[model samples]
Target: MKIRRANKEDVTAIVEMLANDALGEQREDYKLPLPDSYYRAFHKIDSDPNQELMVAENKEGIVIGTLQLSLIPYLTYSGGLRAQIEAVRIHENYRGKGLGKKLFLWAIERAKEKNAHVVQLTTDKKRPKALRFYESLGFKGTHEGMKLHI
Candidate 1:
């Protein structure tokens, strides 16, 4: 599989992978034909200098996985930058084949290229298996994550 920056044409496949899981099926609405909001968000991400929307494609050129990486420059941590990984999803058929780990390690390399002090991500607490997967990859639960929905 080849990992590369996602183009506009890959949005639908990326959305499909994002909606394939239980939590995603509840939160994503791809059934009624995708709305403009998705593309709009894509454009915003595409134009951002600090953000990257990436996709992993198989030999047939099908997008089988995707993730977004954002470089956050902050004053804390001695005014360092961090790479935040988000929206990581791999197609069901592609799971457990070491693709997820490859994707993460690739992101880490990209982070290093950007001179980030750290790489961070947040996973839903409901996914114990995912928690285990991340821990297996050497990520630690260093802090409690809280959210306030508007």
Candidate 2:
């Protein structure tokens, strides 16, 4: 398996993966039900310098996992930056195989290379196992994450 930066060609696969995830099903957050043009626009924005979309591919080039990293520049930390991880998903069949850890570590390394002050992510409160997994990776629940849908 290889972890690489995503390109336009990987958008469809990534969207499918995201849509099939638990949070995706609950929130209907992905543009999967929309036209290809919508995904095109999303891909364009995600691939910009300020944001990053990465995928984990097998030897045959199938995208089995994906994660998005957004750079958040902050003033409180004296111009420090943070990498916010979002939309992390692994293929259904590929769960329980440590692929998620691999992908996450890769993202952390990338964040370090970018001199990020910290790496952060939010998982749904219902996902207990996911919370444990993140804790195992040395992530702490430092703040209460709340959202209000507009």
Candidate 3:
């Protein structure tokens, strides 16, 4: 498996992976409505300087997994940076093969390269397995992430 930066051409596979429940777990409130234009918008935003969107591809050039890393610069910590990991997904058939780990580690390295002070992510409470996985990767549940439906 090859991990690399995602390009606009990979949007279709990325959307499919994002829509899979096993990967994204997006609830009805946060569900991603798939449309051709959605991919275009995502590509545009992901290419901006503050964001890094990546994809994991197999030898066949199929995008099997993906994640996004966003860098938020801060003034409070003396110009420190925070890297937020989101939109992690792997194709159902490719799960349990350590692809997630590789992609996550790649994101961490990318964050370090950008001089980020911390890396953060959030997962639903129902996903105990995913929570454990994140723990094993040195991430801790530090706070409650509350959302309000608009």
Candidate 4:
């Protein structure tokens, strides 16, 4: 599979993978002619110099996975850059084929290219298997993550 920066045309496939799982089924609205919000969000992310929204395509050029990597400048880590990996999703039909690992390897390499001091991500507690998968990637549960909805 080839990994590259995502183009506008890849949004639908990205969202499809994003919505294929149980948690995604609750939070994502995936359909043909997706809501304009997805497009708007895509445009905003696309315009941001700090954000790299990526897509992975199979040999036939079908989008099979996606992730968002954001570079954040912060006072912590000695005023260094932090690469935040989020919204990682692999197409349902493509799971268990090592595409997720490939996607993550690409992201981590990109993070290193950007000179990020650290790479970080948050996963929902409901997904224990996902937690294990991330551990296998060499990520540690170093801190407690908290959030509040508006």
Measured over all alpha carbons after superposition, the RMSD of each candidate to the real structure, in angstroms, is: 0.9, 2.1, 3.0, 0.8
Which portions of model 3 miss their true places by more than 4 Å? 22-34
Best-first order by lDDT = 4, 1, 2, 3
Model 2 residue 119 distance off true place after TM-score fit, in angstroms: 0.6
**Candidate 2 structure quality by residue, lDDT tens digits, 42-81:** 7676757868888999888899999988888989798999
Lowest summed lDDT across 10 adjacent residues in model 2 is found at: 27-36
lDDT digits (tens) for residues 1-150 of candidate 1: 899999989989888888998899998877546788899999999999999999999999989999999999999989999999999999999898999999999999999999998899999988999999989988999989899989
Check candidate 2 and list the clashing pairs: none
Candidate 4: pairs in clash: none
* lDDT accuracy of residue 146 in candidate 3: 94
Candidates' TM-scores? 0.97, 0.90, 0.87, 0.97
Residue 87 of candidate 2: its Cα lDDT? 89
User: How many residue pairs clash in model 4?
Assistant: 0
Top candidate, metric lDDT: 4
Q: List lDDT for all candidates, in order.
A: 0.93, 0.86, 0.84, 0.94
How far residue 72's Cα lies from its native spot in candidate 2, in Å, is: 0.9
Q: List ranges where model 1 is wrong by over 4 Å.
A: none
TM for candidate 3 is 0.87
**Predicted candidate 4 versus true structure: per-residue lDDT over 1-150, tens digit per residue:** 999999999999989888888899899999889999999999999999999999999899999889999999999868999999999998888899999999899989999999998999999999999899999999999999999979
- List where candidate 2 sits over 4 angstroms from the true fold: 29-34
